[model samples]
Target: MSRLIQDAYTLAKERYAGLGVDTDQALATLDQISLSLHCWQGDDVAGFENPDAELSGGIAATGNYSGKARNADELRRDLDLAYRLIPGTHRLNLHAIYAETGDQKIVRNELQPEHFASWIDWAKANHHGLDFNPTCFSHPLSASGFTLSSPDPAIRQFWIDHCIGCRQIGASFGRALDTPCVTNIWIPDGFKDTPADRAAPRRRLKESLDQILAVPIDRQYNLDAVESKLFGLGAESYTAGSHEFYLGYTASRNDVLLCLDAGHFHPTEMISDKISAALLFVPAVVLHISRPVRWDSDHVVTLTDEVQAILHEIIAGGNLDRVHIGLDFFDASINRIAAWVIGARNVMRAALLALLEPTDRLRSFETAGDYTARLAFQEELKGMPWAAVWDQFCVQQEVPIGIRFLDEVKQYETRELSKRA
Candidate 1:
């Protein structure tokens, strides 16, 4: 560890101690929380399913960043670089579109564990877990802006079969790694213009989801989740799987979780305010942390007030045990590895800051109806030496601390990323 970082952490530790916050405990808590790094970021959401396939489903990565992963090996290599810069280890989130089909024409419904054997081996070797997602876009069937909720039964059945296959893959990951893999289902089914009947699509969606979850899967190996979106590129008018739909679906079904994507809501909505309410009825919840500019841009995440509030709410509401935290964003505007490292580091930093908060005292003040002291003490904590403790954490984890970390990213970009054809 660096002596300078340790010395600064010592002073910061003493300062936090006066407020009854234990730096060691906070760091320990941060270490326990694993943020699943989204794999699409490294490749700008361009999966290897079809090298010539263009992005669809109202999704887009806005930059022609150099060295985007062209294959599974390159993606893993880039992820390796990202993990080196991040403190501690975390899980990887994968989409079904990234399956390795080799020269064979393996349809989504026909995908199997063998397609992801390399990923399983790599993750096992790296001591990381895996999460899976069903890709419901960029296919000919979904070009009409509907999949599971399509009026055509044949088209809807195809997606259902694909989702079923994805569940099996997710279970295989969990069985191999001995960690429950969360298989999430998110579809871009909606209308660009006002629909004559919104209820029909939603009803069809509910039926489709029921059919998808009808097959019994062991909870020990796989957990199911549903994600919702307010709107999308062409579907700016209506989204079938709205937040209310998934909330009601998950609440009614004891077996699945509701995934709350921070960027999937309206600009005025805060995911932090919804955690407690969701946890009250749903068995568990999953979070797709991201930054939304004026809309669902999927911008890179930073340690903003909303992010901090999300972490703080999870910690304060005692929802940590029931919430699965994962990052979901793709910014092709910067070094992909650097983007991954920055987002993951910011998440960890927010968690650390939340952990360092004196929640019990604040709660007691709230309980006693002392709102004045509660606000004052909360504001006072804003001046805490969080950066020093974070630097010390990076030192302990044997990663580059502060600006030093960017040097490695630059070096890798010059040596490796720039050489990509």
Candidate 2:
């Protein structure tokens, strides 16, 4: 099977070379793109701090999939297994709720880097990086359906402090791992019904964000981002942190990155179209790639056209270095490890497809007003032997190729996950 993968790649290389595409260079470039895998997928966003609490803040993970990680140790173990199946090295995105504290009751505001010391050590040993977030939902303070934009000053201050703490913890991860950590803030602050005073809430939110980001962290060890959502389970009528809100805020600050979630928009909207425009104002951006079924439903990612288009934008924008790619989805119906493996591999597959394209050729045709040739070449790329190159990449990365990975997933499910209960 190894020899077969190599032989197929050899033939694919020649075919791609005829079109001025270098498969070898594409593979090398793909190897350097590190995806930040969301840790919530392993455990349904119910972290170790208080696992049994009902998911609040409009966040819900449906289905009773077996083997959900119950504690930090188990979650880390599952991530280790999932990483084995994925081809390139990646980072872990952690939320404040995942903090580990034995018996001591430290609230979110008082949380410290020591709480995540184990995570940093693990990342350092494994040669991985870590990103972070402030878990503004699923807590007592957020029961009012507002966090940073809460009417209560005390509640807003609590969330503000929590976000500041998360930024510090993210810095610790970067210092320990020697890679900058992007600490993003996403709060569920909106109204279910129409609000008479919409402007007041946004004004409050803007002020709250100002306080939260007052401190300047070094860019080498920490970066900041603001995430916005169109709506959530409860916040149907008005989401204070809309796309326009964050875009303007990020543009004004010039130091923060705007986070764009694929599902956090109108059904008709696409992030691929926004990436280019956003990059013009902000120096960089953080992408939360998710699949929306009917609403802001976090379904496991598939290799759909949206996924390919998003990758194409990242590569073609000539700003791949300024973008941070992260996966944001959770499916409680299927094997959780397979969910991670499938999402990560499909992202890499899409990236490889984008890379294998002689985009320069398409660009030249478009620049020369050869629109017909551009369309013809794009349609032809669909039939290229890119899968062979993908298989060889997996082979080189020492991961199983094709559906052979499913067999390993099944074995691990039976062997390790079944024993969890």
Candidate 3:
């Protein structure tokens, strides 16, 4: 067991013993925490803008590509900045330009496919971990932002070709880096205005995926199907208006896994328990960690009591092993640097708390529950208030603000270094 898990178990035992609970529940809970930590691994999609600069109104309002470089030299500078800004302990899910450019619908669309070779070379040379989402092209192809049942075969074919190319590039990159490339395939491929079109798109999407999976690739990849809210389409218009359609489809495919985005579940008002249960069957390879603010999802992590309780239950349920906890932030109206910091802190706090929870007791609880007994049972979480625990964990983790600043400084330094070199 990791030292973190061991320490958490000790703390839980000491605390629960004082509560007069001696049924071994506390020890079991601690063991669960240990198991979770043992299986812990995470990564996030890249291109997280800095929150401070974004909020300060530094970025362009048009949402054009002006901040980062498009060439090899520019990429090197950015990679160096990422290392300096993000702490060494934190692993990034570097978004391939394919996904970013596809999402932004840049006029040239030249950053991704055209530049894929160089990006892979850069990652291998620099030793940066990669997290790629190959199907971001579907976002624009969908007329309603998620309807895969479009009659336009031309548009569909375009996306299909793009996905195929992306997979080929990803496979090569993974082999070069000797790292498992996480292929997160999320589509805004649902219906927008009609419920009738929902089933067809989902079916077609599965067909499309089937074709891609048939392609020969050597890299060990996971098809992370991200479930998100129904946009452009009415809530009730889609398949039961939930993400289960996508999940069920991906689960049927070989070597494909689900990428659970915490914010995506917000629209359905599904709590952590529902998420835990839904994903228990399919291993979760990556997690997009963020807080949800009312209707606007993916807010900064605020260490709320509700959030802690939800996360604790999920960790106790045994899905943390396939986790790649990555930062996902988009604040159209705030400083980009501040946004990055907030997103990073959110991920850090959640991870630390997850590491602190007891594991043994949780497993026992899972087994101890008779259908009736378990239904009536309530979990006894022993610790300081969640906020206090969060604070303590942050202190323990020792994540410094300087780490966030490092990326910016590194960007400048890299630029100068390249200029001189």
Tell me the TM-score of each prediction against the true structure.
Answer: 0.99, 0.99, 0.64
Between candidates 1 and 3, the one scoring higher on TM-score is: 1
Candidate 1 wrongly placed segments (more than 4 Å): none
- On residues 353-383, what C-alpha lDDT tens digit does candidate 2 reach at each position? 9999998899999999999999998998999
Give the least accurate 10-residue stretch of model 1, judged by summed lDDT.
Answer: 44-53
lDDT of each: 0.93, 0.92, 0.46
TM-score of 2: 0.99
CA shift at 246, candidate 1, in angstroms?
A: 0.6
Q: Would you list the clashing residue pairs of candidate 2?
A: none
Q: What is the lDDT of residue 186 in candidate 1?
A: 98
How many Å off is the CA of 262 in candidate 2?
0.6
Pairwise lDDT winner, candidates 2 and 3:
2
RMSD of each: 0.9, 0.8, 8.5
| 156: Cα error in model 2, Å | 0.9
